[model samples]
Target: MEFILDTVDLEEIKDGIDHMPISGVTSNPSIVKKTSPEDFFGHMRKIREIIGKDRSLHIQVISLEADTIVEEAHRILKEIDDQVYIKVPVSYEGLKAIKMLKAEGIHVTATAVYDLMQAYFALAAGADYIAPYVNRIGNLGSDPMELIGNLQDRIDDDGYDCKIVAASFKGVEQIKNAFNYGAEAVTAPYAVLKQVFANPNIDKAVTDFNQDWYSVYGEGKGICDL
Candidate 1:
């Protein structure tokens, strides 16, 4: 039931962490390209300051080879903080890197997972978190929820410590579905997550309650005022 943000925007991260019970912030190369910060490591450090040490910060590697990926991860850990989780795509080389990182007691989040087999591989490789691309999977004509559910079942049955961190959401419903299907976490855009409170019915209910209280109290008189 962890709600994570999928962005590198500092202001949005601050606002989201301030108002929401966000577990962490996750960013891939594509998301980082949006911000294009002049000081990459500095910007990441600032993010850590905002979220504090309690929350997790996931940073993806830019290399394609197994050794290079491991090297990039080490550099990121050295530059940022070692507590940062390295997000490696679930590929042939990425899986190799995950095993190596996990052997070193480094946190590894296996990303770009679109199928159950990929998730299984990542889980077996000791990934702390397995990220499944929900929207993209659906676009590929597969039920992403089913995949998440299956993965959850496997984790529960085998006593695996790995968690499913669902990603690539285009709508809030998809995010909800991920949770409903047993995803331990779901990372989505700021706007998509904020839209949960966008329903007019919620606002209307709050406004009506306030109006009734004002009518009885004769205005400007709250429970505290009384």
Candidate 2:
């Protein structure tokens, strides 16, 4: 399973890479608004510098029309690196954009998917990743796990190269649930992913183990010292 960061903040990206097995970085217009970078392309280039070319970088297009979306994708590729994954919403127009980009061999990620059919459309359009809004779907009274499970089944049955990169998480449990439900990757805020280590019991257990070790070894004399 891959852990992807869903924010554009450089500091958070660094932290996520250092602390977690971050596979990629994803950003939407809303996420960009939060950072409010002065130089859009320059900032993206800086991100590429930090993450390097090994990990993926996904950027969403603001255009709603198919032609403009495709145009924006090319512009983004020129502005950023060509390896960047163009994130297109799974709308009627966005699907058209995805098809066109895929035809040109551009990496595409299908976003803003709420329905199973929308994901299927993206898969059929040959998107590399399909992001389902997990918390949003749950807030809408739908079972996100079931949706992810069904999508996984479809992918396995069809042998599609597409991966389910679940998105829009609210808490740590939702992240775990997404993976448990067969998401190949889950993109979440750095803070949300870091919350996996937030439990007091984990800290207490570590403290207890260290205290016992020190009590016998007489302080600072760990196994490495021996």
Candidate 3:
């Protein structure tokens, strides 16, 4: 029901987190590259202070080994707020880590998904969330929309808790399509979310409505003399 800004630049993320209706933040290696080379925990500690403990903050692990990944997940969660969600990939190692983490009562986000099958696999593996790279899949000559559609249908028809998190949104249209496909949540860059509400037509319509209201009555006076 809320949009999560997928960015690593703390300033940019903070800007959106402060003004926009962004429910959370998701970041991967690529996103991290855009941030500082400082310690990852340092970054998360600052983020926790900015977002508070009540909000969800997703942080990905660097380890590919299941044991290492699980350990890293625990360490990361301990450093950040209690709402920090771990991001696990859809692989054999990731599955193992997810199972271990979930058993430990740590929330896990199954990321790097491609199709409905992967989403199903994530659910079968018992992940708390499923992140499908909509635009990245589109770039691969695949219909991410259809993939998400089938995923939603299958999940709702069977009643699964693995939520669909639409990731890698390229534009505003992609955001709309992800919503239409009934993605539980969509993670996009701050720029994309900013463009989502930007439209010349909406601007013109608002101006026209204001002018019409001012004509009969007065500026900022939609109510008549009473």
lDDT at 60, model 2: 98
Off by over 4 Å in 3: 209-226
- Better by lDDT, candidate 3 or 1: 1
Superposition error at 54 for model 1 (Å): 0.7
Each model's backbone clash number? 0, 0, 0
- Evaluated against the true structure, the overall lDDT of model 1 is 0.95
186-214 per-residue lDDT for model 2 (tens digits): 99998898888999999999999999999
lDDT agreement with native, every candidate: 0.95, 0.95, 0.84
What tens digits encode model 3's per-residue C-alpha lDDT throughout 57-118? Answer: 89998898999999888788777755688998888788888888888888889999987787
> To one decimal, what is the Cα RMSD in angstroms of model 2 from the true structure?
1.0
TM-score of each predicted structure versus truth: 0.98, 0.97, 0.88
- Tell me which residue pairs clash in candidate 3: none
Determine which window of 10 residues in candidate 1 has minimal summed lDDT: 217-226
lDDT of 1 by residue, 48-123 (tens): 9999999999999989999999999999999998999999999999999999999999999999999999999999
Candidate 3's displacement at residue 131, Å, is 0.5
